[model samples]
Target: MPAPGSAALGVDEPRSASAIVGATVTGHHLLHIDGYSRTKHKLPTGQFIKSLPFSVGGRSWCISYYPNGLRSEYADFVSVFLHLDKSAGEPVKARTKFCLLDRAGKPVPSNTSTTEPYEYLPGGVGFGIAQFISTAFLEKSEYLLDDCFKITCDIIMSEELRTEDRIAASPFVAVPPSDLNRHLGDLLAAQDGADVTFQVAGETFRAHRFLLAARSPVFKAELWGTMKESAATMVSLRIDDMLPQVFKALLHFIYTDSLPEMEGQEEAVMAQRLLEAAVRYGMPRLKLICEDRLCRHLDVRTAATTLVLAEQHNCHGLKEACIEFLKSPRLLEAVVETDGFEHLTKSFPALVKELMCKLAAH
Candidate 1:
């Protein structure tokens, strides 16, 4: 016989009295299988029932029942365990319950141990009620039918934590950044098979039409739409308003889908032109990046100019930020002297009125 207070589950698992057991029954999940005797009699103790599926915490889970012992040592008894679906992609920290019921729906709580909570990580340990009723003992009992017995499992994960171990992690395969940028950079740098040319301020930059069409809707329209500008080997664009440095920055963005590194003053200087180009090219993300950079550099000297740029580009966020910045009379007095203030006052006279009212109120 097992020694006094010794566990029959072999590992001497943590008992129900441990505080890690279910603190709150968030919800219950149950499973029952029949035909216990005729089918399970021939199976080995270590065998598991067909994986029963359930879900909690918006994650997948599975339950396993070992009708006989999980090992030869425990073959005389039944074992049941709960397994987390590792394919769910993360560990599930949870508390588990296994219950055995008689035909009368009466409880058999004598030894239906509730396992201490554990994180169900991939390739990690599963939790269970190891010391389920003995096979021989239940064979003659009412719960064992002519050939079957039913088992149920209840899982109520912590609303705060999906698993018991907060730090536990499942095996994972790392995903590195794709080589899209590198390949595109190679294509742009080599220009080995350039199919098109862009003429900006009488300077020509060689590029592939397909690459530009892929990155910008404006380019797509010009290259592939009714315009069909790409049908020619070289397309002349009168981008006289764009500086060569700004155009270079724009091309770097198209090829890399990211900004090129620039010093502080250079970055600020490039922002307005980049934002205008982004809007002209129909790239909202690039426009937003430029808007954010511009916003970070706002000062009395730049506020009025940025306000004009935002209004011209329909950048409501930057416009609002500029208006808020000029709430100070000193700031507004300083901004009104800038070159762009004449344009802002003429374009948005109502905004000037609103600012005057705020200054009077202040």
Candidate 2:
């Protein structure tokens, strides 16, 4: 019983033409319409924006424009606003949820969002923002967006929902540097009954003096037991015997996670000790450091020592590195002159044979 234009203005009765246009054109693709007015005032600039329905993982989503639309200039206007509901619910914030894509349509890591901004040009051809809402939120919430409309609402969410959920549930706990230092100091203080203190890397520990008393077999056995039981006990002790020092260093690292410093040292002696320790303890990092130093400071005698350590430690990698120093023409000639070739042949027959064969072939 209403007037003729009442349906168009929601005051008069139903109109066939308006209903037909509204029914047929519902979709996500940007519609190019000329002179379409929504209200009775007949505004020229107004346009209806709808999103294409996308299905990801069997869930549906409805995307829509923000209330303020492009006028808000919030930089995310072109981006599709997402909601699970087909009816009415407050739309979640989309900026933090949307995946930004690059020119090639590759999803950019979110960290890059801070540095980059997208600009919309004059033509209708421009990138649109796509935001994702979690399925858990959709499942638990009471409200729903209008599912009857097929064009604008598509549910495509990322598989990272589980990871995001875990990250949200657990919070990070920060520890102060001073507290860590205090705890380390307490650990250092606990070993008061020791004599010599040897620090390797940043770790400090105590050592009993008698353990390093030269030629004391009893003390050596006891120290060896301690080394076997807890290799880290040597961090505080300096045993003058190179062999024992190497063994203790290696054992200490194996039992207690610590690395000894390579400062000072009789260069050749320390290199040999460190090399031996590296091999024994299976410390690849320490081994590489020792090998580099030895290579720089190589002499005929040290090369011989390195060769022996390489073989003893079964360090194939270190052996190959040491071979570079030992196979040098100068070092090889020095070995021949010093009658050290015999020692080398005796210790590393395979290497000596290989070197001899290469020399003969050359």
Candidate 3:
């Protein structure tokens, strides 16, 4: 037999799609410093104490905590440094972030410090902030509970830039699709460190503020922007006019970038609600996915409602799909008899007129 996927077999030879991706590996370590008052007096200005070595991105690292600051000029401030503990032949490029934790073990967003990617040479080379926090503020803040506090360091290291071939034919190596979604889904289910809560339709849901802020601008604004919903240590929000299941589905998509499998006629109704939720939350991708589902599930019973939804939400593709489905006179007549038809015609007279014009043109 001829070689598989080869031209000799009267089949076009298979070719691999290749691209150069800048891959990165990330890891974090949290260091708890006990007896902060005792340690603060022991470390003189420009002196420091080191945390136990931790490994991140295959490199050994440690944090140098200077309780009295790194220099006399900054003596009134607490300083922190990230040092490379292991020697390497090539320069390692990495970005670093230091975050101070509250009593709840959540990073205080206002107190977090981040550094740009920097190349570290061999030996014990390090980089960090000299004015991490003011000593007076740390002594008075809630972060200093019983003379103890915690800090977390996150490291993102850049790996070698290389091309990867995604092959359909014979290949020596196989790379599986990313399981980030699975990990994120597990995080949502575990709710181990959820920092925000939502009460929707008498049901409660817990989630992380950072994750929510990262996913949606509306969420980001609500959680951390000028809108500033509330200042409670643990924020609890009451979401009105939304079903619990719809909010749950929206959270699922926010975390996993994919929706849970919904089945049958109820799925279409759920998609419609989810589309509205997506719009409310400023999640365009989710809105688009719901629109696509609505398009596929369009029927005489749902066509009128979906068309009204498409019109209200500015869903061009779904609007076209709805119009196409209503083109048949029998289907249009049946749609007109549906319950939503009255609401559609009354609430959106312009859309009704546009639909009539489209039909007349056709």
TM-score of 3: 0.53
Candidate 3, backbone clash total: 0
Model number with the top TM-score: 3
- Reference-based TM-score, model 1: 0.51
Give the per-residue Cα lDDT of candidate 2 at 70: 23
lDDT (Cα, tens digit) per residue for candidate 2, span 65-183:
32122222322222233333333122211111233222223332221111011111111121223212222322222212321111122122232233223221111321111234344
lDDT of 1 by residue, 1-362 (tens): 10011112211111122123444434455455556664467566666664545555556665556667656666787777666666766665666667776564434543355766666665344556545776766775557676666665667665455333476433342122245777988888898767766778778788777788888988887777533644646554556678887888888889977677654567777988899999988988789878866775788778888877887799987887787788877888888898778877888897678657766775
Q: Quick one: ranking by lDDT, best first?
A: 3, 1, 2
Model 2 stretches with alpha carbons more than 4 Å out:
1-162, 165-260, 263-268, 277-296, 339-342, 358-362
Per-residue lDDT value at 214 in model 3? 91
Of the two candidates 2 and 3, the one with more favorable lDDT, higher being better, is: 3
Listed per candidate, the RMSD to the true structure in angstroms reads 23.1, 23.7, 22.3
List the candidates' TM-scores in order. 0.51, 0.34, 0.53
- Of the two candidates 1 and 2, the one with more favorable lDDT, higher being better, is 1
Q: Give candidate 1 regions above 4 Å deviation.
A: 1-174, 225-238, 357-362
